[model samples]
Target: MDKFEQRLDQAARAAWLSYVGGRTQDEIASQLGVSRPGVQRLLALARQEGLVKVRIDHPIATCMMLSQQIGERFGLDFCDVVPVDTGTADSSYQYLAVAGAERLERYIERSAPLTLSLGSGRTVRAMVEALSRLDRPQHRFVSLVGNVARDGSSNRYDGIMVLADKTGGERFLLPAPVVAGSVEEKEAMLGQRLFHAVTDVALKAEAAFIGVGRIDRQAPLFQDHFINEGELDELLAMQAVGELLGWPMTQDGDVIDCSITRRVTSLPLELLRDQQLVALAGGREKAPAILAALRGGWLKGLVTDETAARFILDAES
Candidate 1:
């Protein structure tokens, strides 16, 4: 475009012919009818003039292929696979969360009366952090599951509040526990005006992002005392592999409903039917839980690592 740029391009071509083409500078100079010193000067000009630009092309094909496979397997709207260059799961999860947050910001633009049902998990924590940096107009943010537990270790309230504040959205906090003590307590809490309002928000949510919780001894929700031992045993007995919106689901993603010691969930399976429920998770250990969430039909979108994506596609096959 400019004289300097044109000179740089010429120099770059000369450099390519001399170096990359395996020709010595003297040979290139002879072929191009230029002196050996002149060829060296051209190579120097190529670098000094900045004729090269470097960029990393993300493996979008891998993401799209995985997304299509998972979408077809679970009948979801779409799946987003984030490339994990690092071997660590934390970095991989962060990349996926950031991608999901960006995707959500765009989705919010196209969709109106957007009610967002947020979750609390490692992946969600990262998503909230990433989502906070994005600029967006005011909308409604709903807490799909209770943010606190009896022991009060993990606080998802801060994460949700951060996202809502950053997006200029209204926060609808769920007042009840994630898992109630008894059926009467569950009904009583759900009957309250405050809890009812949150449920209403969940029912009206245009898009919901939930995290799959594993049914294991090291489960975060369980370790945090969000659910009692009895409920955990019940879920394990029912062969539940994962949780969605605080509800137990089998490995195949079927909702496991029966007598349980505690139940405190905002949106039921039927209510989540038509809404966009995106499930974010990673790791081979979470595969069963992720699969369960898919089978339950609670996922409209999914963001995960390549390892999990391959496993999911292979599992279906």
Candidate 2:
């Protein structure tokens, strides 16, 4: 377009023709009516200015390492690694979220009836925000967990709506709480036709996305006081380190079965065997939960920052 850039681009093309196209430098010089040395100088300039930028691409070794480690550890399908940006936790998470969203888009394009289960966490929230930027025409989004919080601050329905609207598909909102007060209450809710239909939609999902929650914080397992204190206490006593799709998972990524979790109608981890289960997370604070989730086999695919990746590897090793 401009003089220097135009000349530089021309020089790059000429050089590539000479070196890569198997044309001798003398032949190229004769064709262009320039001296062989002149052609060499042009090639050098192209390299210096990065006009002839050469890309050597292979699967990222680090990603493969982690993916293979996780897959073998948990028996998963695949894993993707996003490079860690050396910066604040928020920015690192932002990079992970964007990459995770891109990966999700690719997966949706390849898979069908995506059984998406979103978790309520800052990391997951960021991932959903990133996904909102992508344009996809078809894909079903399901809320793997209940939306209402005990205090009513946030819910899964909001997240499910964001995902469904972005992907241009209907969202199935789980009306029941993620954790229920009683097995009977959970059973009764399932008995209702509306909730049963929603649960059916969730169970048939082909892919799911989730986030891990810490044990210290009172996670919004159910939107509004649906899961009782006794159940939460029991989960803690089971040494539960985190949760995925409303299931309490231990430090080793094993799901803890309190009577309440068993009664909940959410899809079980074992059911996710052939499905694409992706977990997006970041921060050193979440290393235990993330590693546990990986070790426990929560994710067949993972998107995370470098800091968290290192932490997961270190903790696992």
Candidate 3:
């Protein structure tokens, strides 16, 4: 160690012995081969430099005001609050992902042969990737939304696929575009036995993990070409704050009725209300959308970072 660090360590030890360890200054001085006054000086220096650290750990269980408030405000069943760095959205998602993984793991372990409805998104992908390896052969993971698009593009955030790979769970995905050409095409697709069966199973899930999406210009759905310019403009006109399972919603969390809603193949919000619907999201950009989802009573649970938690709590107050 460097000279200053070495000196600080020795002084800190001396201070700890005197104050925390309950040793008298004379005893500490005798042990250290120094004068009582010298020991006092060392103790003072340690305090001045913040070398003799004392920590009062506030357990996570006790510091759950945000979690409790969220449950009470929205009548939610579960909520997890993860601390975040006030930096990039990626960093915030990282925190949310770990928290989400832990929460998902616990539920999966307890609920055998569980049916978990999944959503495709960057944050959800990160959460699935962070999950510890497990063999959940009896568990089924169902996609909340269609992966493919009309342009032959697809959601790279196919989180259900990732979860199967990571957890060794069975997975089901709809083999169609997320947004179809018209309402007739969407109806025809949903009318098919296979699509109907897939959606029915998703509705019957014991719990669901969904990703919260903001209806902004820079939203992932638009940026990834899942939705085109016209769709974005329509959502903007609808005053859509955010979306869950491809259902656009306003600031108060009410789903907007529009043509785009007609063409999208995703889980229906009405069904989610009966399940343990947990939405994972973070970052300031998604605050309004997250708040709307909670306010709308669309989600039964939430896993999010501290900054977003504070933002939601502040808005409610």
Candidate closest to the true structure, highest lDDT = 3
Residues 1-317, model 1: lDDT tens digits: 59967667669888788656878888878877778998888988765443332223565887778877887877777787776555566566767677777666676564355667787677886676665234455678878877756654546555568777767778887776677767887888877888887788778887777788888877766887766687677778888777776777777777777665246555676777888778888777787788777766678888887777877778877
Candidate 3: C-alpha lDDT? 0.81
What are the lDDT figures for the candidates, one per model? 0.73, 0.68, 0.81
Clashes of each: 2, 12, 0
lDDT of 3 by residue, 208-257 (tens): 88899999898777886768898899999989999887888999999999
**What TM-score, to 2 decimals, does candidate 3 have?**
0.77
- Model 2: residues with Cα > 4 Å off, grouped in runs: 1-75, 83-87, 110-117, 132-137, 151-157, 218-233, 259-265
Candidate 3 lowest-lDDT run of ten: 50-59
Which model, 1 or 3, shows the larger TM-score?
A: 3
lDDT of 3 at 307: 72
**Each model's Cα RMSD:** 11.5, 11.2, 11.6
Top-TM-score structure, candidate number: 3
TM-score of each: 0.75, 0.67, 0.77
Clashing pairs in 1: 253-292, 253-296
